[model samples]
Target: MRRLKSVVTSAVLAFGALAATAGTPAQAATEVRYVALGDSYASGVGAGHYDSASGDCKRSQLGYPALWAGVHDEYQLTDVSCSGATMADVRANQLSALSTDTDAVTLTVGGNDAQFSSVVQACLTKDDAYCKTATDWMSYYATHQMADELAALYRDIKARAPHAEIAVLGYPQALSATGTCPVIDLGSAKRGYMNDFADALAEGTKAAADKESVTFIDVRDAFQGHGACGSDPWINNLSSGTEVFHPTLAGYIAGYYGELDGAWS
Candidate 1:
């Protein structure tokens, strides 16, 4: 009787041990990885609170990516955006930041390839006619010549990060629709022309996003009343000197970050 009882107790203990082992959960899944790749806009050149480690990339800790990462604790960010990164620059330097493990991406490139800095410089220093002509020429080139390059870049991004959800964030107009305000010396018409150039960039960017079946977050509408000439400008005025025409921290928070949150949510 004693031997039988011991045998029964040992069997029960072995079964309990097996059950406990079976009930142990698997290891927790890794956090989602997010990669940000683009130009000055993404680098937050004018947003202030620049990251100490970013060097000439001038990446701001207050930039939208950082803001987004702050809000999303589950995501790990790899921000490789540089201040003067063109589409080609992205191809050469930034794409490597992405991997199959990447789960999300945001891109704000193509402006430099369109020689957007030159357009802004012309607006700031040249006559209205010169600025207008240059703007028109840039508009034409962006719409016609830059499409293939942008498309290829977008496609490569998709290939590199196959499982990631990509978002192509658009640029805001540097000036309001109709205003003659502080900063750069341009007539209201020239300001309107600058806005038109913003439109051209948006069109090209949207085309690339569509090609990749990615989301295009248009900031123009949200930025309508907050241009450099508006009552409450979110963009840096010419008085900003080296950071002229870039978004202020307000722009990143209220404009860029807001739009990005909506898209992601």
Candidate 2:
């Protein structure tokens, strides 16, 4: 990514110099005033290569937003998505990145609102029965309560960037539908619970997207053969207390970039 950034920078500089020499107006390109807003998934928590300037946001070059922005020179990227952000957090801190001039927006939220990280941790540590019960309750709550919050948030995002092409990205299931992996500490039942939770969140998000009349990017099949328990898992089974059970770099590329590429293509 660093090398790619450098190359892009050089190309931009060269292009500018040539345009200057020709006395031609530098490419009057239609800028993609892109603002990325959401939670840890959008912030690239587990992908590493953190942008220290973002402090605890944990933004990484490997993140889908960054990868997309890096390739699209016309994009004036303002990515305020942060690690541990909920819908409320986005309304508070990230939404300010949007405005009337914003031409494109990509969002991946609702996971933190569902307390997804905490649920995963609990499922890993708690007894099977307790884990299942807790996850089931959370899933129900997220599907019911978080739906309103997500709908409102999406409305606000659209109001803020009315002209932008908005895409609400869905969360990929952390675990495969069946079986257990040695790397993931949870039992088979708990693993299934986690998958259910992901489904619940996805359903709520899709509904919210529909309510707001925005594009809903369902990335379930994108990660179909690469869940955390799969032979080539894209999600991290565990982290060194950073962003546990989150998507790894490959996960973001396969689940996010792969699906979103057409949005800008």
Please tell me which predicted candidate would have the highest TM-score against the true structure. 1
Residues 73-180, candidate 2, lDDT per residue (tens digit)? 677678899988988899989899999989999999988878786787788778888788878988897778888889899889889998999998988888865545
Tell me the whole-model lDDT of each prediction, alpha carbons only.
0.81, 0.78
- Candidate RMSDs in Å, in order, are 15.7, 6.0
lDDT per residue as tens, model 1, 162-247:
99999989999888665556654578768877888988998888887777688999998777788886678889887887677889
Clashes of 1: 0
TM-score of 2: 0.86
Name the best candidate (by lDDT): 1
lDDT of 2: 0.78
Model 2 spans with C-alpha error above 4 angstroms:
1-29, 177-184
lDDT of 1: 0.81
